[model samples]
Structure formats: structure tokens, C-alpha cells
Target: MMLNDIAMIAIVGAMTGVTTVLFGFGGGFVVVPFVYQLFLRQPAIANNALHIAVATSSAVMIVNAGWATFQHQRRGNVTADILFPLTLFIGLGAVMGSLLAGQLNEGTIRLLFILYMLVTIVDCLVSRRFLKGCEARPLSMSTTTVGGVAMGAVAALLGVGGSVMTVPLLRRHGFSMKHCISHANPLSLPVALCATITYTFDGWGKIPDSGFIGYISLTTLVTLVVAGGIGITISQRYFPKIPDWWHARLYVLLLIAVLIAMLW
Candidate 1:
């Protein structure tokens, strides 16, 4: 890769880190499209560029989500009882999603990703309940098992951390934006870790490339993780200071911006 490529990676990595700390994204929303666009022109990996993008996004999320979860826990943002059980279901779903993804065409998967993102954005905007915060209610067994698993499956398939869905789900269920994002971090961790493992092992010896292990581009993964870590360390101070209304508005705006960028 050229120096300019590295520079672009670092730039996007820092932005990913900022989003992780502030929106609980774990770099998926940013990483998937950026990496796909960057690698699509390379003849060797062109056909599998979307898979590589998703796999690499998952690898990046393991670090971003894990680190952000730790920070959120420190602030008493994570609810342990709900988190543990939900994580189990999400993990199971992630493995399922990862295995199924290899059977899909790259264009089909990309289409799914974009469509899901559009739906999510529209859901948040039209709901009208997202900005009004309420006390968080207990998770029903069905929501924990069925919803968690579905979220994991979809997030794994799309290379997202599931924050886009979780945040809105939690918000609709009466969570404040601050705590919703906090909970989103821990919830995303399992999805990332489980998906990464499946992607790495599933694609090994199959991709026909030197720089990739499975669908992951190790060089890109390492660079993004390191730069994202630095970004988290630097930008975390801005997280707690935002007001709830502004926070919720910004979240929607960010999703809209990402949607526009992806479509363009």
C-alpha cells in the first residue's frame, strides 16, 4: 500500500475511534465501506472485497468494542445481568451469520448492508420516540434470546457492531441516549469477537491471497486498531459532556451522514 493509503486508513481509524466512544459503533459503520472501496480495485481480491471488508471490520470491532465497553463499565453504563445472557445468544448467532456469509455473493451482501442501514435510519427518524428518554425496562426473555441473536446474526453478516440497531431498540424501549450507547458497546463486543473468529477460520486456505488470513487483511486490521485506540484515548473526554437531546440528535445525524456516504 502507498503512504497515502496508510494516511487515509489512519484518518478513518481515528474517526472510527471517535464514533466508538461517542456512539458505540465499534468501527463497523465506517470500516466496512471504507475498506471495501479501498480494496475493490485490487485485482487479486476484487471478487471477495466485500467479504474482506466485513471480516476486517469484525476484527477491528473486537478492539473498539472491547475498549469502549471497559470505559462504559467504569461509568456504570453497562447492565451486567442483561449483558451476560444477551452476549451468549449474540455469540451463537454471530457464528451462524459468519458461516452463512461465505455462501452469499459480495454484491448481495453489500446490498443487504445498505438496505439494512437505510431501514435503520428511517426507523429512528420516523419513530418519534427515540429522543424522549425514559427509565430502562427489563429485557423480556424473548427479546434477550430472539432479538439478541437476530441482532448478532445481522451485525455479523454486515460487519457492523450492531450499535445502529441496538441503540434504537434500546431507545424505543425507554433508554436514554447516553446509557443506550453505553449498553451498545458491551452488546457489540460479543458480536465482533465471535464473528472475527468464524471469519478467520472459515476463510483460511480459501481466499488465495498472501496478505489476507481468511477474509481479514491483517495489515489494515492492525493499523486501524492501533490508530483507533489512540483516538479513543484522545476523544473520550468529549463523551460525557453532551446533553441528552443533543446526543440523540447527533446520533441520528451521524447515521444519516453515513447513509449518504455509503450510497454515494
Candidate 2:
């Protein structure tokens, strides 16, 4: 990679790392668009730019999610009871979502992503009333499984870490914002892993020779993962100081920024 490209990756990675920990997302929301823009500048990967961007972002999430999960666990934010039951269903859903993503064209995926953003924005805006009647009861096994599958699929399709959906659902089920984020952090692992593997095989022979394995750019993955890891460490150290209301506001701002970037 050129020095300029390396610099770009480092900068993006650092920003992504902070966001990933701060919001409990896998950083795919930020990574996907940035990587898509970067891929657009590379002729060899231009034809499959969206796929490459999504795949590479998912791959990077493997590292981001793992580290963030560890940090959350250390702080006693993760609830094992909630995490264990959803694993299998989430994995299954991730595989299904990746398969579906492999079959769609770039335009369709982009449109879906935009629509998802709109819905999430609306959900966040009216979240208080929407969750008003929800009981602080334990989620049934069946409900967890179904929710896990759906969350995994959508997350993979959009190149996210599943927290965007997971957090809202958990919140409605009476989980605090912090606990929701904590649980959502670990769920990202399955989605990222499954989607990355699927994308690798889906574009195996179609893309040009561009230092890629299928749709994943090795250089981008390495640089972002390393820099993002550093960002996560730094962010975790200061996470306790941030209030939940501030976190909510930050998430809204993030979604708005991403929406504008995509439209722009």
C-alpha cells in the first residue's frame, strides 16, 4: 500500500475504534461507507466496490468486537445469561444474511442500507413511547432465538455488528442502555465472522487481482484492525465517565452523519 493509503486507513481506523466502543457497534456503520469511498478510487476493485467494502468492514469487526467485548466483560457489564441463549440463533442468522447479501447487487444493498438508517433514526427519535409498555421480564427462549436470527441477518446484510438492532430490542425488554450495549458487543462476533467468510467465497474468482481474498482487502483489514484496536483501548479507559443520555445523543448524531454521507 502507498503511504497515503496507509495514512487514510490509520485515521479511519482510529475514529472507528472510538465509535465502536463508545456506541457498542462493530464499527461497520462507519467502516462500510469509508471503505466504499476508498474502493471507489481503486479501478481494480471498482466493479465490486460495495462488496469489498462490506466484506472488509465485517472482517475488521472481528477484532473490534472481540476487544470491546473483553473490555465490557472486565467492567461487569456483560450478562452471561443473556449472551449464551442467543449465540446459536445469531450464528444461523448471520450465515443466512451473508448468503443473501452475496446474491444482491450493489444498488439494492445501498438502498436497503439507506432505508435501514431511516428506520433506525425514527426508532431512536420515538424510543421512549415505543418502549413504554415493555415489561422488565426475562425474554423467552423462543423470542431470543427468533430475535437473534433476525438481528444477525439484518446486521450482516448492512455490514454492521448487530448492535443497532440489538440495543433497541434489549432496551424494550427492559435492559438499560449500558447493559444493552454490553450484550450487543459480543453478538457482533458471529455476524462479522459469518459475513466475512461468506463474502470471501462469494467473490472468490469474480474480482480483479487487487491484494484481496474474495472481496476483502488485506491491506485495509490489517491497518484498520490494528489502529482500531488501539482506539478501543483508549476509549474503554474513558467510557465510564460518559453518561447514558450523552451516549444516546452521540448515537443519533452518528446515524445522521452516516445518512448524510451516504446521500452525499
Candidate 3:
């Protein structure tokens, strides 16, 4: 790699590290936008690169989520009973999502991404109502399966980890935020791994001269992983002190910003 490449890696690493510490899961959001901007300057890497970028981001998430789960589990917050079945279905869903993404058009994919983010913003805003109802009752297998399927579909469509959806669903099902995050941390591993593998294999024929293995971008992947590792360490230590309302407002603003950028 050239010096410029090394410099880019350093920058991405630092950004990912900071995001991991602050949000515990903003690597993709950070890397994707930053990379998209970088590719705009080098348009040769732009075409079909988004797919590779998303795949690499997911692959990095597998490692990031594993480390995060360990940290959360050490705190005695992860719930195995809920995570097992949910993970199984989420993995399956991720595979299907990757396949679908391979077949979808770029415009369609972009629109879907925006729509999914909007839905997440809506969920964050109404989370209290949903959680109140969930606290009054437990989610049945059918409900859980349905939720898992929807999350998987959206994740595949947008190349997100599905945790934003998963966390909210868990909370609505009466699980506390801490427990939900703990279990979801491990659960995201399968989602990212499955999706990454599928996307990598499925998009191989499409990506060219992109330093990719399937849809995985080595450049972005390396930077994101390094940065995400740092972020995970911080979130694990300070996450508990952060309020849920603040997180919701942040999500709302992020969604709005993404919407405007995509539309413009």
C-alpha cells in the first residue's frame, strides 16, 4: 500500500475507535459515509464499491460484536435463552438478505436504505409505548420469529446489522435496555458474518479492480476494524451511564441527515 493508503487507514482507524467507544456500533455508519465520500474523489473505486464497502463493514462487525459481547457478558448482562433462537433465525435472514442485495439495483438499494433508517427513527421515537406494552406481556415465538424475519430482511436490504431493530424489539418484549444490548451484541455476530460471507461470494462476479474478496473491501475493512475495536472498549466501560432518551434523539437526527444527503 502507498503512503496515502496508510494515512487513510490511520484516519479511519481513529474514527472507528472513537465511534466504538461512544456508540458501541457506529462503525458502519461512520465508515460507510466516509468511504462513500472518499470514493467520490476516486470515482474509479465508486462503482460497485458501495456493495464491497457494506460487505467489509459487516465482516468487521463480526469481530467488533464478539468483543463487545464478551465485555457485556462479563458484566452478567447477556441472556442466552433469548439470543440462541433469535440468532439462528437472524443468520438465516442475513443470508437471504445478502442474496437479495446482490439482485437489487443501486437506486432500489439506496431507497431501501433510507426507508429502513426512517423506520428506525420512528421506532426510537415510539419506543416507550412499545416497551410499556411489552412489559405487560411476553412476546410469543410467533412474534419473535416475525420480528426476526423483518429485521433480517431490512438488514439484508440496507447492509446494516439489524441491531437497531433488534434492540427495540427486545425492549418492547420487556427486556431491559442493558440486557437487550448484551444479548443483541452476540446476536449481531451471526448476522454480520452470514451477510458478509453471502455478499462476498454473491458479489464477486460484479466487483472488479476493487481490492475486494467478494464484496469485502480490504482497505475499508482494515480501517473499520481497528477503529471499531477502540469504540467497543469505551462503550463497554461507559455505556451504562448514558440515557436512553439521548440515544433516541441522536438516531432521529442521524436519520434526518442521511435522508437529506441521499435525496440531495
Winning candidate number (lDDT): 1
> Candidate 2 on 84-195: residue-level lDDT in tens?
7797788899999999998898889989989999999889778882234245668788778888898889999889878888777777677766777788889899999999
Worst 10 residues of 2 by lDDT: 128-137
lDDT of 1: 0.86
Candidate 3 residue-wise lDDT, 140-173, digit = tens: 7875677677677667556667766776777677
lDDT of 2 at 34: 86
Regions more than 4 Å wrong, model 2: 129-135, 238-240
Cα RMSD for predicted model 3: 3.0
RMSD per model, one decimal = 1.4, 2.0, 3.0
Output the TM-score of candidate 2: 0.93
Clashing pairs in 3: 16-227, 17-227, 20-231, 21-231, 200-215
lDDT of 1 by residue, 57-95 (tens): 999998998888888888788887768688888888888
Clashes of each: 0, 0, 5
lDDT-wise, the better of 1 and 3 is: 1
**Weakest lDDT window of 10 consecutive positions for candidate 1:** 235-244
TM-score of each: 0.95, 0.93, 0.84
Model 3 alpha-carbon drift over 4 Å, by segment? 1-26, 130-137, 237-240, 245-248, 251-264
